[model samples]
Target chain A: MPSETPAAYDPSAYPPFAVTVDLVVLTIRAGALRVLLVRRATEPFAGRLALPGGFVQIDEDLLPAARRELAEETGVRLGRAHLEQLGTYGHPDRDPRMRVVSVAYLALVPDLAQPVAGTDAAEADLVPVAAVEPLDRLAFDHGRILADGLERARAKLTYTTLATTFCPPEFTVTELRAVYEAVWGTTVDPRNFHRKVLASDGFVEPTGETTTRGGGRPAQLHRQGSAEQLHPPLTR
Target chain B: MPSETPAAYDPSAYPPFAVTVDLVVLTIRAGALRVLLVRRATEPFAGRLALPGGFVQIDEDLLPAARRELAEETGVRLGRAHLEQLGTYGHPDRDPRMRVVSVAYLALVPDLAQPVAGTDAAEADLVPVAAVEPLDRLAFDHGRILADGLERARAKLTYTTLATTFCPPEFTVTELRAVYEAVWGTTVDPRNFHRKVLASDGFVEPTGETTTRGGGRPAQLHRQGSAEQLHPPLTR
Candidate 1:
């Protein structure tokens, strides 16, 4: 408090901190909510399961950091994915060694035509959300990050048009409905959901095509709509 | 890189870092969305304007850090306020000297009754969101944090019942509508907003009394209802 003036604040007074970005990349592979996780090749928790992450570099914002980390770890381009800033993880003890603050993001990628793992990563796998048994045991506070990401994704579906992020470029209404059911962990009335979708004009438009991939029925195909936000949002 | 197995990452390998929290405390004052900001009383940016904030302690969660900073600088108890994590700011050079990761939060105070200045704050004042000319040049990257907080508040009002957080525990319908108008920076159709509120169900409930303060038509008194989430949320 020696200097009462703000201009005199010495930049050297505080210690430098290292910042990193972590991602809980989510996708639906084979009708299940799956999270993309990586095995750490380095300690303190080396060999344990964790999310794909890296130290955020200079010359970029937090959003780009998340994108960079995701791409580096998974070799997947997040351009078409629904990316958002989840929150920050900054418990002094969250990192045992240095004061490393991590900015976490929730990303939704539709089915990938192919997924390649990072070079330094020991192992990378898509684990089902329901299969994260004893959810409390994830390494390095990642369990908490996963839970928060799931809740944010669920809540976003209620008011935003983010459910489509989990679908293919062209998908059937049935496929869209499945996305909601999987994320919410509850079954919604198909009829009601269909009616609601149609009522919300401009939310989706028919592509004059059909999909025969699912086998049972030839469902009409539709691409993503232009609605940035849902008016009178579809509530859970 | 020497060992066949990855080396045990030592906490001591990296330099120690500083952690801090910045708060965007908002309320509706004088029919405008107002934010609480403080003029820096100490260096880095003494006499210059900045958001109310401080360094984080050795043991504290990101949110608790934000809340503690709020109370210390603004003398406001965050226990009763609507507080939620906004996001984190952690650019490598966000702090000129070292790496300082700042966790930012958006808090809504129903009523900002009295503010006492302490800590590194010069004078805590509620500045109109539209009148932040002097605050445009904030300490560090806080100008960006404030802008992001305002945008979130505006968007949140559209889908959630968070606008009520800018009002007192008990308020009238007109007052509630005013909250929306102020935050969105646009006037809403009173009749439409009122009908929408009633139809939403559980947003507000009658207190069986009328406000005796207003000179015009006496307004019905109401209190916050039990609606946890707004389905088919009110949009701009």
Candidate 2:
């Protein structure tokens, strides 16, 4: 504890730390929640699967840095993805090469084509959330990060209109309910869910279109409305 | 970007960053929500009000760093303060001296004795939230950080039992409603609020005691329950 005086201050005397951004890009495909992961090709955790990320550039903003790491490691563009800051991790020993503090981001995106491993990763692929554990383990505390991201997604889906991010621009009520079922790993009553969703004003608006993609009859398509937060959250 | 191989890797090549922790310690005092602030004793923003904070030590964890800075700058020992990480702010030019990434924390504490400025601050005091802006402003990006913390507190109050943190161990249902009023800066209907709180199970439980400190009939005391997230949130 030294006195706070300019004459005695030395900014360069502080310890140096490296900052990086890790992304937990999630999407639902075939009624399953999946996360985009990469096989690391570097030393500390060589050839092990991890959430795609890298060292942030000096002049880059935190959000852009996360998107850059996502694109560079997986070669998948982040177009129309719902990206947000999840949290930051600084366990001191989380990275072995040096003291690295990583800012983690959560992204909800529509299912796209399979990712190609970019220069940063040995291989890249979308792994099902349920199939990830008790089988192939992730590297460098990634399992914990992925868990947090999933919880955030599940919790936000209950109170916000973010579930539409997992669907296409136009989606049926059944398709949107499947997002909640996939993320929460539970089945929701179709009649009850449809009534609640239609009751929540500013949550969804009809597109004046019909889609018979899934069977039975042509269901009306809807899109996310202008509400940022739901008043009476849809309780599961 | 180079090949991801140990032989060609240089961890030292990454840009260096100095990490710090800034806290938004809030409390309800005199029917108003107040924040703990310090007058910087050093250059950059000397003699101006800023949230109490400091650089993180080389071996300290982020939460401990936040607690240490609170004690060091405002002489506030954070006993029983509800503390949590709010977010991380890292604009490239936020700190004129260097690139400093600050992890902001939110702490909801019961009102305590007047603060004595510690070694890091020239002066310290609790300022009303409504009185902060359009008058003396905070240093750096602290204004934005304060707004984020305030929003978090207001939002969490609607869905969580954290509003009790602003009160003593034993409190009447009426006193609890005052906490919501002070933080949200609005009037809450007393009868409706009491009915809602009592209806929400695991939100509050009767203490089998009564208090008559507010010049009314003996009011039954209640304490927070075991629930983390409310099912049917007590909406305002």
Candidate 3:
């Protein structure tokens, strides 16, 4: 058992740890859910796919570090992405290089912009989540992180207004419903989803504008609302 | 901008970090929400209150380290405490000694054990959460961590079976409602609360037993059920 407090704890003598940030950037592109990933150009997991991230600067805080790493590593700006801390992973052996503690972040970005390979990435692109499965397709424990992020994203859609993050600035209810469909990977009844979306207080606000993009009828445009939570959640 | 991948990335040159686990052991005591805190035995806010936690060992996994530290630092065992990662806090100057990244765990334990002074802690006690307000009463950035934990606990009670973790093996609906009132710091109509608790699918299962412990005409004793999430969540 280690002392909770040592008489005069020596900071320099503590275990050497390398702290890094890993992002699970998710979005809906072409009616399917996708995650941004990069090809590692370095060893240990060389030439394999992994989440785009980098070391957290000694002076930077966690959120800013995550946002910075996303841009620097993948050449992708968050741009209104709903970024949140997913979890932290420290398995001692998770990193063969040393004792590395990775703070994983989940970024839900709108369906816009693509990733380009950065200095640390050999190649960068959005891969359909459907294609990445069985937890071994990606390098290290990244697959697990992605799985957790996906789960959080899916569950949140039922009780949060986050689906709007996957839509454009103003979108039709049909388009909003598509975001749910894509992320949840399940078809939600249009009438039911529309009613539920409207019923959920502050889930969205009508822009008083109409769009023909949804086809059939001139659909009303709406934007994300102030409320973050959905009472009487839209269950999957 | 740093490269996501360097031809042969030098891991040893990365910034050093001290990773620690901070526990927010919350329990319902005397019909009030309480958290376990320890008085720092050494400098860096010595003798001031903070969450009970310690350094993560080189070869230890995070969850195990949290469980181990909780027991070691406060002389308190989890028993069946529902412990889960709350979030991670990494502010460059959070710990004056070094750049420390703390992985915080939220523990909802049954009201059973009390804390005693331990090695690193000069004094240990369960402090009422209501009394530890304003976010600046505690040492370090622990106050912020405690706030996050409390918010999570309050919200989870609305949609998860986690509230049972604060109760003994067999308890009446009244006792369970008290957990909610204490944690949420709001009073709910007892009839409505009882009805909602029993209605949440698999939230609790009858033990084929009754309890005069709650007074009144003997209430039914129930134990936690298999369901982790409440579909029709009990609203706060």
Candidate 4:
């Protein structure tokens, strides 16, 4: 058959461009806020600390790319977590060699699962948020991106049902309280927190069950409600 | 200079990558929100509609890059607007030719100045936010970026000292009400708004002045205060 209309230009016409997806995974662990990070094994700041990231394939949406990176690096499913597009970082100089643009995602996993480090990662670990002080040395411009994502996570917990994403399908109110306390970095009165949660419509509905996750009195188990947007949004 | 340590095969050996900052300039016009858009005059997607943007110069920060882009394309200082980093977007195929990445900023400017089209921009216009639906034809993944930016802007106004950024330095309470109405696309009780503004500490301070910009009873003038973060965030 005759060749179809000539393609404008072959893919080889331009310089080799690398696309990647980075994940700023955050969670509450042991009464402190933590972020998921990995040590780089390959060149380009090998051995330096960095966020979980990897190359994006040719056929996937940006979120899918992030989920793929997460799965590849940590052996986690794209589901069982709260994920959203944080933003993108594409500075020509961001990468030293060729041009690389990264689509970053902000992920909140309720209770972290054991990380199954990918072959590409030198080592993966959960880092306490407080320990990342001198973030200036973080790989890429991710230091800034991480900060933005963290702020968004903190603020979102106050107004949306997003915080619930950080917990299992059915969780105790006390567990939910911890998520708030960890994110806000402030101690909330348990009595007040309890009242507010029940007052906010569609925030949490009783699952007709109770949980003894802790050794104290069994707490009521609740699930996320139908409300998508929180009305009269919760504030500090 | 003298020969230093041979930094053996550093990945940093690659050429300095290029970074760009794109701005999604938004304003409320004609009772509906509008966004500033420019048509590219050169390939990749020449003559296609896209947000106004440009490469970030070596000496500039992200905010400055956004402002410079605005001034270069529209011939207006976007300094007074409420400018915030929306996030970064760097999908490899986002730019067909090279590995180009963009840092996107969301800017809200009070309807103060008219835009003058630029040389690179074949056509410039303010398109209503509702009219420009993200139907897979917005040049790149810019439609997704715009949606995220708009949501951030709308949510921010409810809890920060941001809505005032969309109003002149000396605006009336009623004028302030309009800013919220336009941004949130909802009606607010004027009396409730006035009372709430007075209640929020450092929200606004009386200038002992009044404005005569409109033909009506003199409206009181107030200046923005120095509240970095709102403790009890405002809710609609």
Candidate 5:
């Protein structure tokens, strides 16, 4: 039996479980929300698409582990992405090989070059969120993890300045609005969205420059502000 | 070196880590937000107040492990509480003995009898949120976990209808307001609060009953509504 005394709690007496970190790296590409996926190269589910992830190292912290796994599999550096802990999944039977606990992370990155699979993944691709049949295509419990990450992203858009993470450092309000449109798959009235975005204290601030990217007229450029949360959350 | 091939991923090759579940159970007592804490009875930080927790069994799921730990440490049944996964803590130096990844959970329960300490804890007590010196008093990394749980609960009250979790099945608007007051640690104008609560769609609905709990005029009783979120959330 495992130790019953708190002071005498012996970790070695209990069965040890492997801890892994999984990344749900999301980006807005071609007017759609897409997630980074890797084709598994070996047997548990060979050739199957899965979220890029790997075992956490003994010397690293959770975030560092996530960053390492992401970089190793997808060749994406940590500095270019915004990552946060999504949740942990530890069902007794989540892994067939053994008891494995996964600390899932959610990441958002601006448009970048297509990912090149490195160490463990056979191939890396950005799959549209709408096209992912999580239950049918992904290996293990990745589908559930992906769904939770998407939900968290969607919810964060409502109350946090997270949407800005999907845009360039300097972007137009229209570009920012497009992010919500792509992720939510719904058109928001530009006038209303503009008013609401500006009204929410510290959501965004003018950068004093105008940009005319693929546009007929120059639009005011804005940057993310210091606020972490929106007072009157922009609910969907 | 660890396997670089995805198909060749082996769990046994890498070092295994022990997993545990910790609970940051919160409730309101005497109009103060309180958290359930146990005095460690053994050598690692013995005699310190820490969040009630224990090792996760091999066959049990994360939630079940948390439920079992809560019951064993405090005799609080799972059914009377609203529990959710908070986050996972796994810094390499977090535990002095070995790598122990803890899946922390946050629970909210209605009024209940004082908890009786079990096998591991020397004593269990409800500590007011304001009094917790998380950085200095708690064992392991519990102070950080407790702080995170408290922040989550405080933020949840702003957007989610989580305050209802702190009230009885049937309660008055005043009682509901008290839940907010205790959690937020601020006074809200009663008239404004009443108007806002009634205006927020699906926040609460009358149960068509009233009670004179403290010998004053009976106030209409209300219950939680079906809405998971409060539109135009109650900001602190």
Candidate 6:
């Protein structure tokens, strides 16, 4: 309830603004990167698709609110997924009804089943990034939020072991490389990619198991290593 | 104003929370990296050194609010400084009075004159990072914000040309190295540092000027170049 003015500095002088949390939930599905979007059921872009989000509860922390909203909207528990603060959007005119500030969260979850519409959403679905041209058309500056989240995810793959977050517990090197390819939207040289990934110590560790799912030569499986960062980042 | 509960979905049902912006202003001064902090004059950790900051205006954007608070508290203009959204803090109990969420900003400015305490502050001064051992002692989660900002500044220097933000418009390689040393708190090999910085394309460009301020050897002046990212980042 802190006032906007500094001279008087009253805690309750300024009108309160609604604070909300938005989740940009992303996953790699069918060899493409997709994001979860919900259809707004109310006015103020009523029919437009928007990111899954809601107001933060008065008793909750920022991350907890984000987790609660994500779960309520998509029925996805954030157990092992990677979630981080993206940014806050507080343009006075962003929300039509009144002043509302939204703290966005970027979540990278392993491939999951399709999402279902929750309480506040009319519909929910996973939309491929390539299908959504001119992302600015989404509800209430959400296009900008989505773009920022995607950029953060793509950039994080270069230096962090976040790419592993998109894979199963034990995954082949090809599977890990596919994550980079899908997120970056480009083909990578398999040989060079393998060499570079392996050269970066603690990026991935062998599980001593091989996958012959395609009836070809068995590919060794690996799991995420302890190191969080790539010493020499795999630049795009 | 969005409601806190999804079941009712009333925009006006929930009370509004106060939103503020806190700034972590950093600069390289006197061969050390220091942050600008203000001693509070009001209750709730009064007399404790906290980052200079204030409430966001109803009509202003987040960045503008940060700039205004920073200038008012420290008498430093953000005209040439590098500013970016750091993160948002929204623990319901962060403020004892009410629910307050703070959007934090990180700013890197060139060395400047000493600061004068402005409104809402009893004292304003630049304290070296080494001096603030347990940064968490600052007023109301500011210490954690400062730690996060410092880690971000260090990590950014590895992959971005952000080191230039700490230097003046025209500076020598030695002066640039000093920035790295001060922020990272480690001495870098001059020869290797020079070679690496120069090899990184568009990192810095020669200004065809020389300065012998220290009276050792004339050092050529350089300016920040167009590239924003450093490929094969210089790791610690």
Full ranking by DockQ: 3, 5, 2, 6, 1, 4
Tens digit per residue, CA lDDT, model 3, B1-236? 12444555465578888899999989889998999887776768776788888888889999999999777765556766788999999999888877899999998888755545566636777789888756786888999999999989888887788899999888899999899888877888999888988987888999989979766798999998778775566755
**Given the true complex, what DockQ would model 6 score?**
0.45
lDDT of each: 0.75, 0.79, 0.82, 0.71, 0.81, 0.82
**If you assessed candidate 1 against the hidden native complex, which CAPRI class would it receive?**
acceptable
Candidate 3 Cα deviation (angstroms), residue B13: 0.6
> In model 1, how large is the Cα lDDT of residue A46?
71
Regions of model 1 farther than 4 Å from truth = A1-12, A40-48, A58-60, A113-116, A185-211, A216-221, B1-9, B15-17, B41-48, B115-118, B134-139, B185-211, B216-236
DockQ winner: 3
Candidate 6 TM-score, true structure as reference: 0.92
TM-score for candidate 3, residues paired by index? 0.92
In Å, residue B135's CA in model 6 sits off its true spot by: 1.9
lDDT score of model 1?
0.75
TM-scores, chain B, all models: 0.89, 0.89, 0.91, 0.85, 0.90, 0.91
Decide which is better by TM-score, 1 or 5.
5
Candidate 2 regions exceeding 4 Å error are: A1-5, A8-11, A75-79, A134-137, B1-5, B8-11, B74-79, B205-207
Q: Residue A196, candidate 1: how far off, in angstroms?
A: 5.5
RMSD of each: 4.1, 2.7, 2.5, 5.9, 2.7, 2.9
Error of 4 at A53 (Å): 1.3
Model 4 DockQ vs. reference: 0.15
Candidate 5 lDDT by residue in tens digits, B1-236: 12264454566677689898999999888999999887776667777888888888888899999888777766767655788999999999887778889999999987666655666637778888888864567888888998899889888887777788788888888898999999888888878888888888888889999899946888888888778675666746
Q: Score the docking of each candidate (DockQ).
A: 0.35, 0.47, 0.52, 0.15, 0.50, 0.45
Q: Give the DockQ-based CAPRI class for model 6.
A: acceptable
Report the CAPRI category for model 4. Answer: incorrect
lDDT of 2 at B222: 85
